[model samples]
Target: MMATPAQPDNGNADVRAVERQQVDSPFFVQTLSRELSASPRRIAVAIVLAFTLVRLVWAYALGFGIDESYTIGQSRFLALSYFDHPPLHYWIAHAASVLFGTGWAIRIPTVLMFSATSWSIFCLTERLFGGVAAVFSVLFLNLSLFFLVSAGAWIVPDGPLMFFLACGAQVMVRIIFPSPGEKEPTIIWWILAGGLFGLAGLAKYSALFTLAGLVFFVIATRHRRQLLTAGPYVACFVGLIAIMPVLIWNVQHDWASLRFQTGRGSPQFAPSAFARMVLGQIVWLGPWIAIPLVQSALHAFRKGRTERELFCVALAVPAIGYTTLQALWSGAGFPHWPMPGWLFVFPLLGARLSGRIRPAIHYAITISLLTLTLLVTAVALGGSGALHRLNVPALHDPTEDLIDWSPVAKVLTPLRVGRPDGPAVAGLDWAEAGKLDFAVGEIAPVLVLGRDKRGFATRSDPRLAGRRGLVIVASEEAWAKKGSGLSCLPEDPLPVARVPVGRAGQAELTLLVIPVEGCIGAAQ
Candidate 1:
């Protein structure tokens, strides 16, 4: 016989069973101190608070942006190859989804990865500088605008990439100049690092840039002697091997991804693009601290013969130089592309400034840090309306460095889900196209045709015309390069849907959905 709901605990058949987890699992209550620091106890409480609150703000307030859906979609596929980027972030995010569950889980791996990196930075800085600089440095990293906004909530190659890159940086510095009383870095340690690089490379092939950075940066400095060591060479080669699956995948696909990325770099490497990229980096670095960081970077190289200083400077120089070259060579680079460069430089800056930047540098750093935090709070809380209302030109103007996919995804998702029979080729927006490729892959595979890229369309070419299911995922500016019909649209959206996305009630996205789902099997 079944017991009623009013039965006592031991005798009640209706009592719900509760399982034990961590001491502070969601089921348990946590203290204020427990929710604000690095421990699992603090993290569990704080993560739920931050992630849920931020996600709600973004979910309702943010319209789907160009790359959002597609990045999510790519993570869904979890491959080592893609039309753009290697497959590391995608697969990890996918794996995280499987581990924790998707939607929010897509972001969990990145969150943990970034946090660990920050913690490692804290430890490294603590060792290099004093505890004060270390704490502030990690604090600055976690609270910084780019950290919270672009790189934080936004799941991309750079987040996981940054984590591993930062880890490598920690290991790298130790290998170059062992700190006083520091243990000798062993071969097993190098192997562990080699594995991290392999995993990091899967995030973005540009990790090769880091590999190149290490070789050149070391040669440029006192660690130049260590270059003769077999460990160093083995470490480098092993990293390449670790990520070799992606290379193999690329070769099988005729290196289409590499050509697509490298070929695109030329226009961005032009004079103007390079200048914009530099300016963007300065902004992300925070203007007040940016100058000093630059000073520290320059000083470490120019004013130093010491092994410690040389080792620190060595890591910073090459990756930044390579990134600059790529931007000048192409008209665009991912905004977060400079991340590993930042990771390398930060501790270098700390090491240089340890006894120096403190107290004196504290004022500028504090002002800069506070200003950034205020700006972030305003932006995060939907208070950017004040800037817009005041007609701050910066509030309304769009810089071309980054693309928005929020509105476009909003337009595509419901319409496609509602209809379940439409997909098409896009004329403009690889970010949007890539995002769309990711978002729609699970529900149905959409064939995004090449309207740009000078004719890169093996994925959806004429070889499969008679097959069913297809769609066009183009933006107006992109279509202008080729489609006269799309180019000539006189306002009102050229036969499509447009959705806008933004915070503070402003529209920021534009997804144009045209029915063509019949070409899916064809593309497949």
Candidate 2:
């Protein structure tokens, strides 16, 4: 008020104004900064909503995939376990199917599971580092091609596995790195963590790697006292109890499930499998994520180790190592095996990006955002047939597996609609049977021939024992080579129709009307 020499024209305020101008100079950067500055909760919600919208669009646009068809068939009958995976996905699908209906309804649980996984990542990251890291973690995870577009969006076990793993990771973080002035949490956190780990096990056997990671962390950090505590034992008990259904099912069936799962891994190493694993990691996880994972491991080993350092290393190494071992041993295309491994690394990645590696993180975000836009565009165009004009080879056709089965349903409905009580529609294997069933929507009771005991094999219809049915056979090269011209009635069959079902409706499959001469061979 005393005329204060006109405030002395402080140069600091002028410099600050210049700095603000520089910060907001670029329109794109300004927009991103504004977004990042939003409340972490709001940012998380927006990310989840955006990711969910993309998934829902794809779900609505595309028809059921082969695996989805199989899932629906399995969900139709509640079981303690399944031939291919545990029962959680089927259970969720069963509930969704009962509540909403099939088709998109079966996928609703995946969407919700993925949302939960994303939110869990945000929470875990925020707790470990801060809000900015949480946002970055969510973005990196939700934008991954494998995580977002494939397993994360599909109605599969991986969806639930990732959700529970993320929940368990948060609890594990608290156990390993409690904040300052904090007492160790009651056994509740460990109990909850174990329960989540158990649920993850119920989702997929790969969850063993998660538990292994926990052990590795304890051993590496010399935190053997954790073993003496009730937390570890409780976790073990809870996880075992969670997967009790699988164990019970195996016991009743004479350990068939355990035998089958264990038999999958053989000790034959293939260099090509390792190469594929490496390449796939780059493509699906994106270089942004892949690099950070390697960096996190390196930092843990090369620098002073802390609970944080050791935790990140353990979470990623065991899962990735197990996946690599599988791939090298079996030479199977197990690209998504390392998904959970990549998951816990996200927070560490986010922390690194927000700290000294801010420049690299900025570039990664830009690339990932652009890549996501392109992916959405491609998926949309795929539905509209715009991408088909590119004449991509069938082998490389990403949408080949998603071929519209409505045409097949149309042709078979006429043949089966008149014979609902008899063996109506049949397939040479469970996959085709499930596909036909999903497409026809109960126009006929679809049956599978041969010993391919998948989901459809478990369903025995006494009516199908000797009844004649129309068999829909996929036009594989092998089938064509042995062609005696498709037939019906096993003794002297007749070809009812050979309908071509695909993008252009060209006959790629032959529907044979065959009578079940004997008990169609049992599922192998």
Candidate 3:
């Protein structure tokens, strides 16, 4: 045994030592910090491009979500505004649809918008803190799930809202905190800020919270004197003017959108709902990241000495506060609703995190990358129908939503139910209508049969009156629940086809195509 004990493997020992040095040593951190500082802009751009590439792949992998389907389907008409949100994102998606013919192409604008958002965050953070902080801020922004997937790649209003808000915040910061030599920010800067804020409003009504934050910042800080200047008033006026279209559209619709939005907030309080909402946010933002973000926000409010710290806190509080209240009161508040407000907290978080030890940063990055990889993998598997093989229960399978409804389109396209001056296709629910509308595309006039028709109610044509057509029942249970509504037809609905819809090779649900005569306008 003594003779068998030979010399140690120096090569392996050396490699282990090198690994430890790279992972554990401060020298590695210093080198990284120097590199990041040397070319922060390039690193930021690289982060944006890398995330953009991942998002592009993701966009192609998954089918459109319910909101995305609704937005794109309704965007075909190109209105002044939409039932759910303002017209900006819809217009952007519409333009992309026109150029690229819908499908995944509609998500292009949102994807690119997030790129701009990343750049804006980088610039804004660098201006407030420093280059290293700015780079980390962009990295953190892209790493967060809500920002990475929802705002980054999805066809949603959040993308444009985040972009415009970030840019506006940057402009507002310049106005509030001028350089040492500069006496005051120019009027042009104020005007630009207002215009940017207005565009943010056009993106989503929630942008008002950020605008309020700006006002609060002006009043609470030494910048209160700036509020007296015409610069502030002119900015407000410009912002109001920019969002006039939303007002005009609302006025034309008898303030229906306003009423709908205002009415969404519940009058009663719900502790469980509020808890769920907060937890949902933590999950969406990632627990590790969200915890630090909360700490950063608290730190900024408690001990922040600089104008930048107060600025982020001011802009962030209103949105996060209001949405949290809405969740407590309504119980129906969504997770992503508070995201734009949290967008401001990133710089503070970046600055905070950048000061931590290298191992901590590495740990956070590893966790974030792992989470993203898992999410992307799940999406990819679901989109490719591989997950269906697992036989996960339909209700519990989150990936079920990613199932392609294009199969339904293939079945219905030949029928031409939406043809003008002829029959129409009907869905029992608004969500179903959206999916149906997207799938059928220009081939048919898709309408909602039941109440809660959303935008489809306005888009429904009188010409469809008394016309016979096919109704797509998403499941047997849905038909069982709503099939009686079609009883008014002269004859019973004939089962035209049974389209098996699911992922992979398993059938999770079946699409029932039933032909009904003389019931085109009956259910609505």
Score every model by TM-score: 0.71, 0.84, 0.90
Q: Please, what are the lDDT tens digits per residue for candidate 2 over residues 243-356?
A: 999988878767766676777646777879889988888878877567766786676666666666567667777888778767877777577888878887777777766653
* Model 1: worst 10 consecutive residues (lDDT sum): 15-24
Once fitted onto the true fold, the runs of candidate 2 whose alpha carbons sit more than 4 angstroms away are 1-41, 181-183, 265-267, 356-361, 385-395, 406-421, 440-447, 460-463, 467-472, 476-478, 481-493, 503-516, 519-524
What is the Å distance of residue 155 in model 2 from its true position? Answer: 0.6
- The clash numbers for all candidates, in the given order, read 48, 6, 3
Where does candidate 2 have its weakest 10-residue lDDT segment? Answer: 477-486
Per-residue lDDT tens digits of candidate 1, residues 372-462?
Answer: 5665564444433343345565665332212344345555555444253443444334454555555444555544443443212434443
Candidate 3 TM-score over all chains jointly? 0.90
lDDT of 2 at 108: 72
Candidate 3 weakest ten by summed lDDT: 462-471
What overall lDDT, based on C-alpha atoms, would model 3 receive against the true structure?
Answer: 0.80
Q: Rank the candidates by TM-score, best first.
A: 3, 2, 1
Error of 2 at 361 (Å): 6.2
Query: Which is the leading candidate under TM-score?
Result: 3
User: Who wins the lDDT comparison?
Assistant: 3
